[model samples]
Each structure stands twice: as structure tokens, then as C-alpha cells.
Target: MAASQKPDNVAAVMKVFAILEGLAAQPSIGLSELSQRSLTSKSTAYRFLQTMKELGYVSQEEESEKYALTFKLFELGGAALEHVELIPLANVEMRKLSEQTHEAIHLGALDEDSQHIVYLHKYDSQFNLCMNSRVGRRSPVYSTSMGKTLLAWMDDNRAQEILAKTHFIARTRYTLTSAQQVLDELPGIRQEGVAEDREEAELGVRCLSVPVFDRFGQAIAALSLSFPVVRYEEQKRDEYMALLFDAGKRISSGLGFYDYPFSRS
Candidate 1:
């Protein structure tokens, strides 16, 4: 417990991760290029690639001998989509909350590439929020409730790094104009464990959301409820905020993750 693991003993795992990462960065790659890029010896690269192929994480093109990722990676991700796991749990709860409040519910995760909210699930509200976003759509994190909840939990430096290259697209009059304003709101968001979007993403939409944290206190995803601003009047903001937070916590607990403010991992 007191000693660091020896390098040679963990080299195999490290090599595999490097290979996977290299493959991930490229659309498709030949073995020679992969071996060179990953800096692993050809034999070692081929051995690990063969292992990954068997496991269905990598596949070789029959036409060109190039390697690409396979749906087996999705199979691995599917482990996290279990009903008691994060994705499935969020999906079901979002539907339940949408039915209960008659407001659209959504789940989003922070994408490493754009720091945008990558949509996962969207529950239709009976009252119709009029949003047409679907799964796999990307929205600016600066103005979206999903983005704000996850960003509100990030550390100052980490958040700045993400938003630095980020272009603050003004989707509406209510969209946040600068990173400083976003940084300022984080403290209060951290205190309350919830974030609100008042017509930030659109002219008439209002969103209330809370982050879904893992057992390690990392915000891997977020849960949100959206409705028309006319429906979620200022008088009801606090009440609706409470309901969304409760739903967020329930899903977190249901996933076996204790709800806490997200740690900047």
C-alpha cells in the first residue's frame, strides 16, 4: 500500500492505453503508423492490437489493412448504461420527471473536444418547450443548463482552460456574455448544487439543472428540466429549482453514487 507500482509491471496496461488513444486520435491507421506514433515496438504493438481485436475494441479494414474502432467499444460503454448505472438511470428519471412536471428533461455530458454539452437523452414535455434538440447534438456550455451545471462544479483553472478556446456564441439576449460572469456564478452554484438558465439558450426557454456526480465526486453528467419562461415564472423559479435538485439527487443515489459537490478531478 505504501509503494508505487513498478514500471515494468504496469507497462502493458500503459501501452494498451497509448495504443487506444493513438487510434482514437486518428480516423483510421495502419499498423506501421500506429506502432510509430505510439512509439511501441512493432511486435509489441501488433500483440496488443491483436488482443484488442479479439476483445472487439479494434478492427482491421479488410480493404486496406487499416485499423479502426469497433462497436465493441460501445459494448464496453453499455456497461455504464445499465438501469442502475448513470446513463440508463438518467434516461429513465428524465422521462419520469418530464411526465410529472410536463416540462422537457435532458441529460448532457461534457465533451472533452468542445467543452460543449453533448445531448444523451431528451424527454418530451407535455406542454412542449419547443426545443428540437436530439441525442448527439452539441450545445454551447456557456449558455446551456447542462453545460452550466457541469461547469459550475469545475475548478477555476479547469473551467478557464475549457472556456478559453470556447467561442461564447450568443444564442439569445439572455446568453452569458463573458467567462467572468460564469466564473462568478460558480460559487453560488456550488453552494446550492444546482444551476439555472433563464432564457439563456433560447428566447423563451428556462432551464433548471443539477450535476450527477460519481462516487468519486466527479460530475460525469447532468440532469435538467426545461420549460417556457412564461410557464416558469420568477415566482416559481425557486420551487422548480428544488424539484430538479431532488430529482438529480435521487438519480445519483440510485446509481450508488453519494451526492456531493463535484470534485475537480
Candidate 2:
């Protein structure tokens, strides 16, 4: 970034960036309102808006008198999404896993921009294991087993940052609201290569997930299976865990992990 002539500081950059983010967060933003909400002088705000307009980042609305973002961001992001190769590479494998276990299977990657679990595909279970969940939907990273599987594998500093921003809302009674407990389980989850949610997101819904790595040895996403909690009582719990681990291993191997580093078969 060019050093600004005007005695640059974090506060100044934050204010300016907040305005841009505010506009991006919503569909449109107006001139006077953007200045007030961003807590910046009208002249300074207008100058930045004009700069954004020239850079093809923001556009003016004729009737609403609002500014909206352009396609510049997506043009940058879409390229990376295409390169992941999980959509085509993992689709058939996900279907096979779902069929094998008679439970729903999902493929998700941590969306860096949103810090949420972005579902790539959701293979329907034989008898509908939680029909409520949708493909392309995002769940909080700290709330889902599929999310925690990846989060637990991350380094401490990165995990702390994630937990700091994470809201940890108890979607159901079983949800982990305390980061301390979740952090405590990181080591075991990392060692075992599997994570579980016993009715955490919703009542009677249990899920088990294991991490899927990329060629770069990064935990890119997780392969998960979900079933009703009642069905997983006692002896059945081990079976469910095994099924998720086996499928996760297959998916990870297909993604270029010749040998899954954790939880041997």
C-alpha cells in the first residue's frame, strides 16, 4: 500500500475500510448515511467513494441514490473456487459414502472470506437424515462437527483467532458455548482424526466428521455423515464413527493424501 501523505494511522484505515465493508455487507449504501455510519467526515467519505468508483469497485444507483459493489471481488474469488476440484472430484465419492452408510454425507470447505463451513455437496440419505439442511448453506464453524474437525486441526494461534470471532451460539442444548472446552478437545480430535456432534446443532441430530486434506497438506475441508441420535446409542456410536472415518479417509486419499496421517485403518 502506498504511504498516505496524510499522517496515516490504523484508526483512519479502519474507518475508511469499515465504510467500504458496510457497503459491501449490504446491497446499497447512500452518501450521507455512509459518512455518518462510518464515522467519517462527508468530504473524506465522498473522496474514498469516488476513488472506489474509479477503481470499478462501487456503482451508483439511479433511482435509490445508493452505491453498490461491482463484480471485481467475485472475479477474483471465482477463480480460486474453480481450482479446488472437490466439486467434481468428490461428488461420486460422497454419493457412495452416503449410500454405504445409509446416512446423509456432506462435503464442505472452510470459506476463508466468511469463516463459515460452505457446503459443496449434500448427498441425501436413504431415508432422509435431517432433510432440513441445505446445500450451499453456511453453518458456523464453531458449531458443527464438520467445522470443529477442521478447526481442531489448525494451529493454536489460528484456532484462537477463529474462536475469538466465533459467536458459539448454542443452536441446541448440546452446543459448546465455551471455547475452553472446545480448545481442550482439539488435541484428541486431532489425534483421532474425527469429531462428533451429539445433537449439537439440533435435537436428535448426531454427526461425525473427519478432515480432508489437500495436496499442500492443509486441512481444506471435512467429510461428514449425519444420523438421528436415537439410532447412535450404545453399540451403534462406534459404528457411526467408523463409517465417517472410513469415508473421510477415502475422500482425503482421493484429494491427494496418499496416506491419512491420523487414525489408521
Global lDDT of model 2: 0.77
- Give candidate 2 misplaced runs (Cα > 4 Å): 1-84, 128-131
Instruction: After superposing candidate 1 on the true structure, give the runs of residues whose Cα lies further than 4 Å from its correct spot.
Output: 1-84, 261-265
**What is residue 211's positional error in candidate 2, in angstroms?**
0.6
lDDT, residue 95, candidate 1: 73
Scanning candidate 2 in windows of ten residues, the lowest lDDT window is: 1-10
| RMSD to truth, every model | 12.7, 11.7
lDDT (10s digit) by residue, model 2, range 170-208? 888878897787788788888777888778877888888
Q: Model 1, 25: alpha-carbon shift in Å?
A: 22
Q: Cα lDDT of all candidates, in order?
A: 0.78, 0.77
lDDT by residue (1-113, candidate 1, tens digit) is 31245476587787788898889888899989999888788899999999989977999999999998887777656645642367677776777687678888888887747
Candidate 1: lDDT over CA atoms?
A: 0.78
- TM for every model, in the order presented, reads 0.67, 0.67
